[model samples]
Target: MAGNSDPLTPRAKLAVTAGKAVAAASRAAGRGSGSVIGGRVALKLDPDLLARLAQNLDVVLVSATNGKTTTTRLIAEALRAAGPVVSNALGANMPAGITSALAGGSDAKYGVIEVDEKYLAGVARDTDPKCIALLNLSRDQLDRAAETRMLAENWREGLAGSKAVIVANADDPLVVWAASSSPNVIWVAAGQMWKDDAWSCPACGGVMQRPGDDWFCGECGFRRPTPTWALSGDHVLDPHGSAWPIHLQLPGRANKANAASSAAVAAVFGVPPQVALERMYQVQAVAGRYDVVQFQGRDLRLLLAKNPAGWLETFSLIDPPPTPVILSVNARGADGTDTSWLWDVDYTRLTGHPIFVIGDRKLDLAVRLEVANQHFQVCENLDQAVQMCPPGRIEVIANYTAFQDLRRRVGN
Candidate 1:
């Protein structure tokens, strides 16, 4: 059973006071996850209390290595377009964040949350979402989430015997086959040919061979058939120019993929493709990922590379300028403890390394940049890195955790 004491009750005034104090402290500390972080600690200490608070809400659990935040936002937007939506908009994908989002919203028609892959099972078990949007599985957060295969297996075991409406990525042979046996599966396929990244089969651990946009594992005899929702050429307009004339504010192949997936989910909820398309076309750019900003008379493109796959996608879209570059890499405990995934990033794509490498671990990034055979200026201190960057023009590439840090350090 869940906790019985009313958080807002006069008898529980002390708890409410404590929650407010923690919230104030968090704000003073300049951390978004302040009160929510403290709440998570308290909730974990009393599991029943957490369960009681989440009594009758319908949850929409969205889990994926990449695009979780974007998709979650899109879903929430679509639902809001349909009616009303409640969600954690600040990239708080953990249990505590989810709990905080749902704590006092008793009338929420839709509780959409973007969940981290590692904690999906626990969240699902606790909330029992009515619909689960399982985005494509990729190599992300290797240090904490373990290998991709391990996370997939955990998802398989976690969702087993459940009756949740499973929305799986059909283009990803891995996601499609994993949900094959599920009662209700909506498989969404990727439409772009240039957007080919589904390289292997999730089942039987076999290499997949792509035959005309469809993948078939020769050894395991597993292949993804035509998708229920497919976004192909022409339909997927370029960021700059489009045959259909889609003015997508977001850049990169990954953003396009995020758009496609979100549109598919919107359609599943009965939003017409044309209407969803319009909603997407007019949507604002995702705040951090490939979010272009103006700084000191030069166009600053901030690309957040959280994982190896994300980095690869960013590299594909980036056309590095002749000017020197500023690269920031830092892994504080809050950002992410694991940095081993750096080895997986295709750093070799950064062929012509720029002049500056900046972050807490400047030497580590400098070593990664050394492979390009280019000279680099290392600034271990972030403040120094900003001072070291050429004043006239600079391009910045930051990983997941470092994006905020760069923005703070550069006053952007």
Candidate 2:
């Protein structure tokens, strides 16, 4: 079957039509992006609209605490080589967003979706995805997402009965624990540079030993699973140890890991490794995650780092010394009101570089930087901060809302 040619009942078809009308009305009124409202109405009407929409398409689901948006984009881009691929490019990962994407691309034969970590199980079950990518899990929105371990348990239970092949990051203990019970699994050593959240075994609650890069739990014998796909620097190695060079326009080791995982997922769908990497190289940015724009006579590169683990991975991508960096933080509902995760990040790595701080929570970041003995100046606005820095390409890193705000302010 091609596209959403799935046999939908008359009521389901009517529900989809009504949902599209509501979405069009929302866009006409300039209320919002209109993505959520339509999906909301559609689901209300049919109550099983997602499953109906997902029927008869090759679906790939990407979920994690971080990099889901980018990874989804990479997978979607790679899948485009085969045919038309539908995806939520707006970084929407909830049931509403997934419904919106599927509805919008009802004619597409392939679907690549980024799913919210909390809703992955339900979405996976509904979509019956052919492959599911489980990236690293860490502490995010404690007030909302609860602890990282609980989310892993949810994934563990949800994935145990899933027939879809699981492609997981073997380096992350949390991901390992969550995907261990999966019958069909493809482990990828996509690299995990941050381990603050995975110090203990999620299975037995015993302290995990990290001797070199491998991790193991002495009490339960839980350990990092051997990877079928591995990333060695910029090279991606297959099970036979043959390697393909991955060149990405998006910088960072985390992105390389994303590329590796994407390649693995693509391979499962019959896309060649070289072909996947070639498509990934063509991707410049993912919904403004990494985009360079001219603002106030300066070239500014935007990056989003919401949690401690995110910050750790993003910080590693920054050029050392001599380059000025802008750090923006916000404690909004979307960004997790608690700014305490800032202290968990190793701000000391940025000590020798010139840092300018700006955001609703800029003072909190300034205080943290001071405690870390990193020199930084507080700026009232992003443009002013960009001006304060020496003229050239400046890296601007922000949390969720702050990054969105700056992206709008910069006119991109």
Candidate 3:
């Protein structure tokens, strides 16, 4: 604790002690991971506990509509190449989960946190992080969280005078508008797949004009900034114009885009692009995402695509046509509680595949699939759904809760 004048206060220590005990109890109970409950208890004991725990550590917060957990893991892996790093690896992004992560990693010097889009402002305010990464934003959990535009506005106000260097996706207009206000910003051209959310400018409500990869607003002059880093097809280019080919164990084009953002964020923490990319290649899966588990005499590749924006990227990752694809839908609070977002996704992309619908919201998915002129069989649960399909390799795409459910039953 040399050169550290402000150690944890008495109240904060008590809070941490109480939180850890509850967390241990929770883990022993077999109810859940205890990431949220433990941190929630800590916050209740001392409102300033999060700030105090994060005071010594260099923090980086990653936020986006999709890829929050994966990007956070990639960034953490990159940073770990340089030093001991801590993170909420369980896909917990709230204050409670983040606090629990910080509390548990007392020995680590660097902390990379995955933050919920709505909670980013508060976490940034509390943690006083050195860097922040804003990935693409789209309509997700509309019933629970604010629209992408409102989240951008909040991000603008929350990070207005912050001293942190923001590593942002230049390809996303919403991310651009949110991070542009920051004094130090590194723009990375990591492509955006969903354009429906960014058609109108968040600044002036003017129509966004997209000429190739660049986006601009004519009315108020809001535009996509020139990126110092970019993803050109299969490679990621650094600020020095050096192209690095990314060989990741993680799958899909979207994961590659996510890695590009993670490398940029890691560089700010003294981890070079080469070292970052090398370390990132070692991460095979993120919280069971893209993890292929052998279950019931078949290979089940599990993936999470919770919304329209996520679904758009997810479809490209799956095996084409004849592959049996199981689409699991859930409208639980954790999954956004609105099945209308299903209609926003083009179910037609999955037409050629042998589609089997499963989960609590199977009926809702069936209706959307029917409307799209795609034929599908709706099963009540995952086991029955999987049994109905011919078993060799099956592609399973689920929303938030549905993915977690499958991971527990099959992935374990």
Candidate 4:
């Protein structure tokens, strides 16, 4: 605290004190010190508290360009089938969010977290978890996070000497290249016939290309073996009874990769392929990530598009324009300061007419919608937008903050 000069520094201390109070209450209720409150108090003080907790437990970290929350939840659930577990199910990937989550669980032998790529190095250095799962690397939020290479470099430097078991997507040139030298590595490649957009090898940058069959480094010839487990057959089954015959719960091909990564983690935790598939199929979506809701007799789809990959996935989920959508974008600090990544998303795919649009940056979304030859009724608030929309097929797309407000409004 030597360099801490601001009086507002009380935030951390206040959070810690409140955490201790929760811990005492849990203890009074017959729970142990390992309960949520106690764990949170430790996290608040340790900043890297989760890693310290991992030193003595089975710590599994899930990070990715997309599907981190869903994969984290899926893996946590699968492991919970074995025993007690803890996770950041609220989709807070930052340090404070993580601290809040760990401080809330009790007697959990397993700690599963969905960490953001930008925070991976700090979290890894502090947590030293037993397992680290890197789902994939894609062009996302270039304004906030540097290109994917920066994140990969940080991962390489941060995990250089750790004894963590690295679980990676072999198909992703970045992930495979990062863990190539590690002895304790588990590579999970997507099945054949899966589309590949891997452009260059993040390590050598020698036009790392994926030939027709699988991924092969054009420069180093560093080829990755096929995934041990792949999503086979023409149909995918979901927990909410939605079936994707040669499709997925989320709209695009990228979610398929996310699902594969989740299954790989489940496999390592001793979940049988069939059982994992059954349990996986049972999961429809996590909050803010294409989570479908039935709002007043209408199909309300909630999609969180924080980054480019996420936006593309959202675009793929729907067919065309006239789908009746309500899109919101929050330019608030909590949602990140920059919104330039919006240019990377293919909004041209939107051919449907939207009923209502709202956000701090509603004009931004309106412009995007207008350029796509679609106009929407602009509203001042998310609640108003939800209320204004006709009680029929509706899709609510939002960024982080707007989605939070939307969730509260819709009671989801």
Stretches > 4 Å off in candidate 3: 1-5
Cα deviation of 188, candidate 1, in Å:
1.5
Kindly indicate the candidate among 1 and 2 with the higher lDDT. Answer: 2
Give the least accurate 10-residue stretch of model 4, judged by summed lDDT: 1-10
Model 4, position 45: C-alpha lDDT score? 63
Candidate 3 structure quality by residue, lDDT tens digits, 1-412? 1125476889999999888889889999996887788889999999999898888788999999899999999999999987788899987899999999899887788889999998999999999999999998899887988878898999999999889999999999989899988999999999998899999998899999999878899898888899999988878999999998898998889999999999899888788888899988889988888989988788999999999989999999898778999999888989888788888998889878889999989899999899999878988788888899975799999998998889988955
Q: Candidates 3 and 4: which is better by lDDT?
A: 3
Q: Which 10 successive residues of model 3 have the least lDDT summed?
A: 1-10
**Could you tell me the C-alpha RMSD of candidate 4 in Å?**
7.9
| TM-scores for every candidate against the unseen true structure | 0.82, 0.97, 0.97, 0.78
What is candidate 2's lDDT per residue for 1-412, written digit by digit as tens?
Answer: 3443557789888888988899899999987678889889989999888988888689999999999999999999999999889999888789987898898886688889999999999998899888999998999876678699999999999999688999999999999999988999999999888898998889989999999989999999998888999999899998788899999999988999999999999998889999989988889988888898988888888999988889999989987777899999999899888878888988988977899999999999999999999999999998788878986789899999999899889988
> Tens digits of per-residue lDDT for model 4 on 292-353?
77766567888887776677667666645566778788877766777766666667666555
Ranking by TM-score: 3, 2, 1, 4
Q: What is the alpha-carbon lDDT for the whole of candidate 1?
A: 0.65
Candidate 2 regions with alpha-carbon error over 4 angstroms = 1-4
Q: Where is model 4 more than 4 Å wrong at Cα?
A: 1-52, 103-106, 191-198, 208-217, 220-225, 233-256, 281-284, 294-297, 319-321, 353-356, 375-377, 383-391
lDDT for 343 in candidate 4 is 65
**Candidate 2: pairs in clash:** none
Clashing pairs in 1: 3-48, 191-231
Model 4: lDDT of residue 87: 86
